[model samples]
Target: MALSTNCWKYLVLTFNALFAMSAVVMFGVSGFLLYRLFVYRHFIGVNVEYPAILLLMMAIITCSVAWIGWRTAKSMHHFHIVLTGVLIFLVVAVQFSCFVWAMVVWDSVDIDIKNSMTSFFDVANEVNNPNSPESIRWDRLHVQKGSVPFSCCGQGPLDAKFKPYTADCSTLYQRGCAKPLHQYTRQQLLMVAMAALISSVLQK
Candidate 1:
């Protein structure tokens, strides 16, 4: 299907806008995380090296891709079919990788939460013995951990009975709970996949 010039223009505009928005989101998230790392040295701990760098790199790459797409939109025939195929493949690969990364991070965070909870439970049980002052400290620590909810979902442990956490976590946990984070991550990945698929179809 040969898209009209006007339609192509609109597609380019839309694509550029989406990429710009994504860039902003990436920077914002990464900036906040970096700030947290600065303020609370151990907030996310030593494992924090990848996410910030990845977000910044993604923003840069998205901007570059958007620029290329915008510039090429007006001269679609200038590129050979093989080149177009390569671009399409890259787009799909990038989006898929992003989806996988999000899933992995989400899963990691979930595991951390679970481990923390388990430790809290153990400490709570030990502290409840009534004979140790350490028990009081353990109870306090348990309360603190329970009070702290997963940052991604913004739902505290107290709210774990709610919809997204209850339903989404179940599916995510069943999916090996290793790299995949949450159902939301899956949804985001699907959106990226759909965008790439649609763009490829339209280009054809």
Candidate 2:
């Protein structure tokens, strides 16, 4: 038992620096994304901003709690040791909550995207006056990524394109963007959430 405790002590000491470094990087990146999302919110939708905010919060809390844990671990006081354990428990709770939140977000992403696209087109299509600012912006958006225009016909695989059969629906990725994209996105994020949950549990 003594040997195991000593091993953990040294490991924490070794990793505390790395933890601090990683926290700083996460904080910076998430903060930047949260800030920039405002400008591009209209283009991609506001779905991204919320996650960035969540990420920033997690980074700050994790880093702060980790430092307290490290400090309390090094202390000889019984109270400090108890505080350390409590802090670790709090981290585990937060991680679990984050995992749950991520899954919920995963389920809603497709619906959110569909609504955003629908709302955008309703206002963007200045078909009667192609020279209008909205029409110009809509055309510019389409040209930005030819693959995006060609990939999905409408919101989902079952959905038909708003217009008649075109090269976009006939030739390129024969499906709606929503289902496949949602599957891909959820798969990626699930892995991340699982990793984070496992890491936090292990840390505890």
Give the candidate number with the greatest lDDT: 2
Model 1 misplaced stretches (Cα beyond 4 Å)? 1-3, 41-44, 78-92, 95-99, 102-204
In candidate 1, what are the lDDT values of residues 1-204, reduced to their tens digit?
A: 455767866776676667556656655655554454333222223333344445446556665666666666656555643354466457556545554554465446544534544565467566666445445443343344332122222334545575443334443323232122223233433444343334333333
Error of 1 at 187 (Å): 18
Total residue pair clashes for candidate 1: 4
Q: Tens digit of lDDT per residue, candidate 2, span 1-204?
A: 988988877776656655555667666765664565444445446663465566667678768866875786576367876776676577667766766666776667667656765676678663546676665555555544333542234444334655443344555545334454345445544654564455455555
What is the Cα-based lDDT of residue 183 in candidate 2? 55
For each candidate, what TM-score against the reference? 0.41, 0.58
How much is 195 displaced in model 1, in angstroms?
16
Best by TM-score: 2
The global C-alpha lDDT for each of the candidates, from Candidate 1 onward, is 0.47, 0.59
